[model samples]
Target chain A: MRLNGNRSFSSFSFLALASLLALFLFFVTLLLSVFLYVGPRELASSLLSEEILFSIRLSLITATMATAACLLVAVPAAYALSRFNFRGKGLVDVLLYLPIGMPPVALGAALLIFFGTPMGGIFSARFVFEVPGIILAQFAVISALATKIMKSTFDGIDPEYESVARTLGCSRFQAFYKVALPLAKGGLITAVAISWIRALGEFGATVMLAGATRMKTETLPVAIFLNLETADVVKMSAAVLILAGVGLTALILIHKLGKRWPAV
Target chain B: MIRVENLSMRLGNFALTDVNLRVQRGEHSIILGPIGSGKTTLLKCIAGIYRPDSGRIEMDGEDVTELPPERRNIGYVPQDYRLFPHLTVSENISFGLRVRRSGNLEDRTRAMLDLVGLSDLSRQCIKCLSEGQKQLVALARALAIQPKVLLLDEPFTRLDSTAKVRLRRELRRIHEQTGVTIIHVTHDFEGSLNSRNRVAIMNDGRLVQDLSEIKKYLDEKLGYIPIDLRAGG
Candidate 1:
């Protein structure tokens, strides 16, 4: 109808048009909020706060670390899941996906309960409530997402590439590192950006497991939440703006890199 | 040498039983069969992609039934060419060399590209390639590793008639030049078995015929089959 045709569009056409319109409205709201609720003047004062600065820096550092860890762990996990046909493979795959479906607060609380009780009695002296706890919480969230995305990417790749590499005298590991990994660079980078952004935006998990201490455990989301309850809407909005900017930048980078992916 | 003795396996909704064969070093053998004849399955077993339940597969007189595919040192060119879509033609050609940590990768890749007449398209992305070009790249990539054995599954299905003739001639030349053992799998028996030293005819998972008695077999058996063997058909 919108394309000026007299006849009604097909279901697929209608579905696509609906999604496009929904996405357009979503971006419109985001832009409006950034301009009206969290304008430049509100951001100026927010940038001066020690708590906000500390939270921002901490979030960036921990999220980056989490991204690295997740990539290292998920690449092999996803590759195995995609390529092999072993016993209980389905069960292992589901377990890897467990944390993704759970609410972040519930996931964090469960981890806290498990790690804080008997498990913590063993290693709590070193892990929970510290910077390690924040990293662990971020890792918990990021790794699950990275594994899911990376698995789909690995699935998209033809297994014959690895098989061919193997015949060429490359060990399985070498084939993965040299051939499969290079081919999957686009999906892997996309996964990294997504996981990084998600880790950077994590709130309930970091807050529940790590605690929102002034400078010790407070993260960007925690700082934003704390500022909001205190009625410091201007500073909160500025932090929100910073979060939105980072997310937008990540999305743009993903799009650009996605376009550059080699077509073998 | 590669030997498959009494290979039998039950695949989902299909089965290959008592499959047996041998390929001497430097021999060029082509497999011919109808659809559902387990030609591809037999190749898969040799390539280590499928494990036969009861078979003794020996490569160079060593039992390789337990070996993983990556350790088999056997090059396989799958149907569809299976070129890595994320790599350029040059990168695809060099993939095997890189995987093997073989020195002189550039020289090997260059020679293979030249051999396959794909040197000019070496920098092009595989997705941009025509069907024949992609097949050429895939062939070159397989040859780059210099494996002792090469297995090609339906190698010319995607090529046009002109390209197919060229590829067949090129395959013969490469087989002679490299002295590497070659096995070709195809359902198009007439098109594939031409001039190959030996032909293995399979049907319903069994070796119905191995036409090594070339002149006699051709006159007696092939003469009766209504398949096209002429060049342009």
Candidate 2:
């Protein structure tokens, strides 16, 4: 009887400690209530609206392009940082992390200032406040995170792989492409997925660099904000749902397709 | 022939100094060193994996000091057998030929497959391979390049006793069949020191130039009384 009394109190304390999880469940369920409040037909029509569709299309296209550009530059940068210890490497590493630490809006402001320079003036005239500006903004902020992920990934792998590959008659570039790149498969997928989501959800940089021009440069996040300005709750909710849905889908696909690459 | 003259390198805190050796063409030499004695550093310098400091490396009587690894054609098998986990055993073996665009790629790969006796497991992914199999794959991959010299760094470290004995025999056979200059590094004395292969002893990043000093050196420092000393002489 005494033992049972002690166990009952411990179990109660354990259940009380789970309060944060219960709170999170309550919030998620409440957020999901938006789909129920609006009729399914109305939600489907809002989803199919031309304006909403354009935002979706633009967001997907620009985010994908940015992620690809980020990958090309980040792969080598990450490998070098992971493997080499050269002069000023410490400074370079710290500088790479600066973006991840700083606010995206600050990065956007710096990019905007750069565009006014003689070198960037012509480029900005052509692309700034345009679709390309959105991509640039997303790439600037997201690549740092991607590079970090990739560097850590490369760090986990041994350097002897490259050394062995080199002695197997592979040139440095061949060794990287054939061995290092293949071994970095799982990390690549994670980097791309995370960068893609980051690009998709980017707002601060895009708003500052591209400006939320309706039907011109507005992404899904911008659309939600724009609808809020006009007090269009339905359209804002629709935009919110779209963003959440896309993120959920991406995560699911990553989870499923990630199996193709053998886990380390 | 492969020759090292005054080879020195500083990889982080560890230093290899004034290491020198010359292995004749078609010679099979084993370098037995204590752990952390820069056996790998010397091998890497030979393979051009790491640039040597204050020294020269020559292969086939040519100063390969300025040559890159690919140009030197030194087949290296690292201790851990860093096989590309994404590739099949077949792809791993044929990687060298594929990189060079060798037209006889299939025949060379098949020969290596048969040589390593891993033909049945050729199609399997590297992640699924055993440690012994990975070691063989690494060896085959290195040899497929038809390198002028083969540098193996503790290739038998992770193998079982039975596997080690079998691989030692296989290494000897391969040495005879290929006639390639070979330098194999190991931390074991009894296993690596054999009569057929010429042996070099290393301690604390330096190789013993005069074998006459080995007994006193071992007895006073390393504390090893070799079996030959116990022959009742």
Q: Could you say which candidate leads in TM-score? A: 2
Q: What is the C-alpha lDDT of each candidate?
A: 0.82, 0.86
Clashing pairs in 2: none
**Tens-digit lDDT track of model 1 for B59-79:** 999999988887787888998
The segments of candidate 1 whose C-alpha lies over 4 angstroms from its true place after superposition are: A1-27, A30-39, A262-264, B193-196, B210-223, B226-233
DockQ of 2: 0.72
Instruction: Tell me each candidate's TM-score.
Output: 0.88, 0.93
- Candidate 2 residue spans exceeding 4 A from truth: A1-20, A23-27, A117-119, B221-233
What is the per-residue lDDT of model 2 for residues B1-233, given as tens digits with 9 covering 90 to 100? 88899888888888888999999999988888889998988888888888987799988789999888888888988888888787799999998888888999999999999998999998999878887888889989999989898999998999999988888888888888888889999888777644467777788888875666566665765577566543412
TM-score of 1: 0.88
Q: What is the TM-score of chain A in candidate 1?
A: 0.89
The 10 consecutive residues of candidate 1 chain A with the worst lDDT sum are A1-10
Worst 10 residues of 1 chain B by lDDT: B224-233
